[model samples]
Target: MIDFSANMASLMLPDGRSVRGPICCEDDIRRVIGQVADAYGFRGFLVLAVPDTGCNSLEANAIMTTYPVEFLKGYDSAGLINGSPVIQRLRRSTIPFTYDAHQLARRRADGKGDAAICVFEQAGMPRGIYLPVHDAGGHRAAIAFGGDRPVVSNDEMQELNLWAGILFSKLVEVRERDRRGSGSLSRREVECLRWAAAGKTTSEMARILALSEYTVNHYLNRATRKLDSVNRVQTVAKAMRAGLIN
Candidate 1:
């Protein structure tokens, strides 16, 4: 666990910059979020773009995460996000809140099995807190810290809120900086890159977008070249770094 008092003391410098040092890249943000989560007694953290609608999967909007990949895959497959009380509350409320799997299961009316809740239990993260923030464009985003710990006190919540706000601000700053350096990507290209990053194949992307395989390849290839990447994998990395695709 981090020394919370010391961390707060180092949070700001004379000029208002982070005393945490320069966040030169996304990995820096991930590292900081992970370390902070552990200090707060959380086992995992996720930073994601909150969708305008509840229909989107977690994988589609995730910016950075310390959650298990297999759990993410299973959660997406379960298709319970739209029905999740946690997600619904997140969409409507700006205030941070704590949630548990049982509450999520009881509050949902979708008539689905407890697969999603079970997954959470199996992952050993039955409870967590969600802190909402926004990007430079005023788009809503959130940071979630999950663990089996007891509810945080008011003082702790206040500290976490300040940290989350500043962390997300730094994330937007870094992404904007990278985006300016990269060439512009078309909407179609961005769509293809997003799917690719989600682990979709060319054929799958084509089917999902109602385009031909040739067209999907065309868009992806163009995006790759525009980003000056050597291949699809590298293209995804570049697009992610540039914030072209979340």
Candidate 2:
């Protein structure tokens, strides 16, 4: 687990960097989310807006996520957002909750839940905690932490719930700022991000683009900075969200 201390005002990253309050950008929020997940024994976390009655796509509501890209694809493809028992619980409950794949599967009578559970289990995250939250505009959203460990205690839930609120609130702030002051990516940067989103390695991208690996990395790095992202993953996520790349 990651060793760190955090408060409403500041967070100490595992690498000893101090992000003192007010997460200013996507990169800062990503670091905060990663540190919080590690400190809580989770493999990764996802923050997304809860779809209302008219919303049909998970990708449309996703805020930011550290979950594997493939896992998300499978989850959306399986229609788990609407069919999964955990989501059912999320819709009705205001309190934080913990669930495992089998627990949810067993609750369904038609046995279709088993298929959904399989998709979740394949992500290597069999259990997780979910915290319900609201945006500044009062729209519902949730934060989830998933891993292989047993369910967390109520005390742990309380702590995580507090962290979730702070994180989500800061997320709203950062996203608003990002949208208001978004930067444009160059054509080469957009191409690099598109390939990176496709799971291409730097070397593979270089070969495909007929550029040196160093040149590919340079473009990616520059794109990352332009997007105020910490790494390639965040860069791709941000670029995709901004409609700069598919």
Candidate 3:
């Protein structure tokens, strides 16, 4: 079995910006998250945007959702469960929560549960728990410990959120950096280019990054203009030459 506890310290992205260490591609993203899930013995994971995230562009660094590659590929793209109360609570609240699944079950008895969403997806179902980290701005993401038992309890929730908060806050800073020198690329744009250099297609990138294909392409195009490159491949090469994608 792979040991993830040791690997946790090395989960940052390549720029040394916020991700614990150098992770350059989707494989790296998947590998690290997969490790976290395995270490916690959770069923799956996801990294995405909270609803209050103020998006300036359709291709902004609004979110980066990750799950088992297969599941990500096959999940109902229609956002089948976006309106469930559990997810709504996940979004609006930054204080960690320990959902009383029994409470929810009782609510269900009174015809209150979202039947299509299932107990597995709900944190208060008495079986799974969602370990969420919500930034002060309400941009949040979560890791679900949905299996035979709960991996995240209320106490553990505080610790995990504290750790994740530090990492994500740094990421948001880099991704949304201000314009300068008449040619500034935000950190998110730089990251997208770096991944592209490593051969990640837009759709593949969208999966690792909680974004739509159009959004991924938007970051690429913006970065390309900033670097004055004529095309995607050229953009990648130029980014390398300028120390943007090393």
Candidate 4:
């Protein structure tokens, strides 16, 4: 949702260098990402959406990366993001961490290893540092810089962490701005959807909100209609994506 062509006419980096010109298309975004990756001494980069609490599912369309397109397609086809050990670790830790492909392969719960890691290794990127970011509302995301070797220096890690955090914040701001442009959901609808997104049942939500079960279902059904979602789960997901509910 970033209007890169409008907002990113030029970007000034911390190093005092200017990244010039508007990002006119998807290829331009990729070029900008590649430039940023090179500036941080990385061969590839990824932006991943962190799932909401108690939700193991990741949004399929929420990923952006400078990795090989075919490899990314393969990873999606394999549905590896749901079981990604790197993302699981990031969810538990506050600080950025480095990971090797082998370590990730070994950490899979199924013990069969992840096809994404295998693809990354085959693509010559075996290790990387992951920088996690969370907003005040508990919306989580991560920016990862992948390379052929580990980033060993603590100072470098700290620097990259700061830069990545800033970049991710900007991206989040853009997404929120775009979401705000959509038709607004009412307060009760959002409240009900938030609880639904948190995995609460209609009866539980009714109890918590001090509303009748019928009223709770009404709010949810209204939200679902507004979001054009097929059901409660899809409604919650759409609401989250639109920043209408946390």
lDDT of 1: 0.76
RMSD of candidates 1 onward, in order: 9.5, 8.6, 9.0, 13.2
Candidates 2 and 3 compared: the better one by lDDT is 2
**Model 1, range 122-212, lDDT digits (tens) per residue?**
7778888898988758799899998899987777777778888878887787767756765877667788899999999978997898654
Q: All models: lDDT?
A: 0.76, 0.75, 0.52, 0.67
Candidate 2 per-residue lDDT over residues 137-199, each given as its tens digit: 778888999989779987788767877887787777766664565596656778889999999
lDDT of 3: 0.52
How well does each candidate superpose onto the true structure, as a TM-score? 0.70, 0.67, 0.48, 0.57
Residue by residue across 41-73, what tens digits does model 4's lDDT show?
A: 788887777764455434342355656555555
Q: Give per-candidate clash totals.
A: 0, 0, 7, 0
Ranking by lDDT: 1, 2, 4, 3
Clash pairs detected, candidate 3 = 12-19, 12-20, 12-21, 47-65, 64-210, 65-210, 101-124
Indicate which candidate wins on lDDT.
1
- Report the Cα lDDT for residue 227, model 4: 81
Best by TM-score: 1
What would you estimate as the lDDT of candidate 2? 0.75
lDDT (10s digit) by residue, model 3, range 46-144? 555544433222113224433333333322332323434445676666555545444554544325344423433432223455556655565566544
Give stretches of model 1 more than 4 Å off: 1-9, 12-21, 183-246
